[model samples]
Target: MTDALSPAARLALDEAFERDAARGGFAHRGAVAVIGDDALAAAARERFGSPIRLFHELTPIPVAPPEGCERHGLVPELVDGVTLVVGELPRTLAGVDEIAGLVARHADADVLVVLAAREKNLERGMNERPRDSFLEVAASRGRDKARALIASGPRPTPSPAYPRSEIVSGLDFPIAAHGAVFAGTRLDIGTRALLEVLPAQLDAAALPERPTVVDLGCGTGVLAVWTARHLPGARVIATDRSWSAVSSASRTAQLAGVADRVDTVHADAGEGIPDRSVDVVLLNPPFHDGRAVIDDMAHPLFRAAGRMLRPGGTLLTVYNSHLKHRGALERSVGPTSQVARTPKFTVTRSIAR
Candidate 1:
């Protein structure tokens, strides 16, 4: 289970399983789970035996399924109406014309498909790299299904918009971030919302006798030092995915003269920290993934906090009001509530128990 998956992927597995299982009945009509067709069928068969007729169809593609593993192919006898609009998927984004052209001329079926893998790799998906079906998980996961999950990896990473040269301003930021050079200028709204209310929400007990604050996904370390200066005894750990962001945050920390107090590290978004040892986790989380429309990369932040927060520790984050995630925030984050809000942004205070 701790295979190639990131912490985010590892954590999302159970929810995926429950979603997949609920889609297919324990025995009745066959339900196709595209992610791991072979595993599901074997499990289903083992549990049901021959008394229940579950037809499992695996697509002939070689890649693993999106939500599960694939062996050989899926059986046509398992489901009754597939909802995955393959052409609507990101894997088909480039060749959408061809994909849509095919789907436009396609027929309907009664099958359930659960696909988690996408046959496209980073290269093919980007069009710069040649297509190698052998290595492309997106191209193959359970393909031939009436209704099943299609293998599309977690949201594709958007190409960095700012160039290396364009990130020049960050060089001046004192001590600097992990790789340095990112989000250094004016505070972004997400970061701003966090700045406006995070301190007031945190009390003396929230921190340890010697507090440690992680400015998670800390683009440019604005909050890292801010927390250090305001909290006095608190040590701040600033981090981000972009090397540039790390560089800049480090500089900011040095400029603040809290260089030793605040440590900036290069990390995979929220993957940098040790699990479950933090006092307060503050984030002005990313709201957009480049030009594409994604509000937040909540899966990682939520899962990472779940693993990192000491029992009863808290995760304080800011979000735009329009994207309202109060419900999702409450569900993923134990006992969550809104701490601050403006017409544009809302600060969420969640305790991780």
Candidate 2:
């Protein structure tokens, strides 16, 4: 692990490895895999002679593995034959469940999975979800305010439950989502709020007969598919940094029968999209970095919207009311005005100059 590891995570990793060594040296027998390219990955590389593979769901920086190691998307092949998997625990229970399932089904039967995180970030079902796939789940004693969950003994793996699909209330077609994507198949409050005012804003805006729409940070393809369905001539580009979200959004667009109009791109802040080319932008900017609620997460999307919008184009956003992001929207995109508001969320429209 990195020298910068917090005290808790350091202690948890020490305990986790000590336990694994005591249990017949399972880690030394086969390939090691790491879910994130962080401290856990560094540790695995040091102890196990370079991680066989590394995976990250959302990374703006390209993963450049050392000589022998390789980087992979969240595919089943990531864990194939791996005997030890180490990483920071995911924030969501569904994310934990998906990781557990992938390891149990694809990794070695005797594989040890060590997940560590700050104690405050750990929550219910973090340990319980791993138990569904493994025969044993144990927690390390809390130290330095960090803890770890170690799962071993794979059970008979069941069919994967990820990329789940369901029909949301307001939409005519079902949305699909991988475990890590925010809100899964359900439309989140912010997106719902924005959707309520979107049609009117689109109508009022001076858009072309066949304008190109960009769904920035599109989670599960809700806005992209909805816009494609409502505006038959409009082409929708759905973009997100998370591979899981991109995969889920692609599946959602396909299921909604709008795949031809809705294109999914795995990108950070709409990177690779030509500047000043988009006629309309839809965004429900994320506010959380891991489990910590912060306003910084939304800034990039706001700036991306500003750069992508054509002159006289529209940028529609929904955000937590308390974040008070209207000023940022104006500074980044253009003149902004509130379009709708609920107790918890506010939807705004910005005009590109």
List, residue by residue over 1-353, the lDDT tens digit for candidate 1: 23443222222233334444566733443332322223434443343232222222112233343333233211222212332221112222222222222222221232222223232322234332112111122222233221122222211232221212222322233333221233435556677667666657786335677877788877767788778877888777887765446656766776777788888776665664777778888876666653345765665676676677777888897877887777766666678887877898888888887
Off by over 4 Å in 2: 4-16, 26-28, 60-63, 157-159
Give the clashing pairs for model 2: 1-43
Residue 216, candidate 1: C-alpha displacement in angstroms: 0.8
Top-TM-score structure, candidate number? 2
Q: What is the TM-score of each candidate against the true structure?
A: 0.49, 0.91
- The lDDT values for all models are 0.49, 0.83
Model 1: CA > 4 A from native: 1-183
Which lDDT tens digits does candidate 2 get at residues 53-140? 7777776336566555677766678899887887777778888888888889898887888888788888876878888889999988
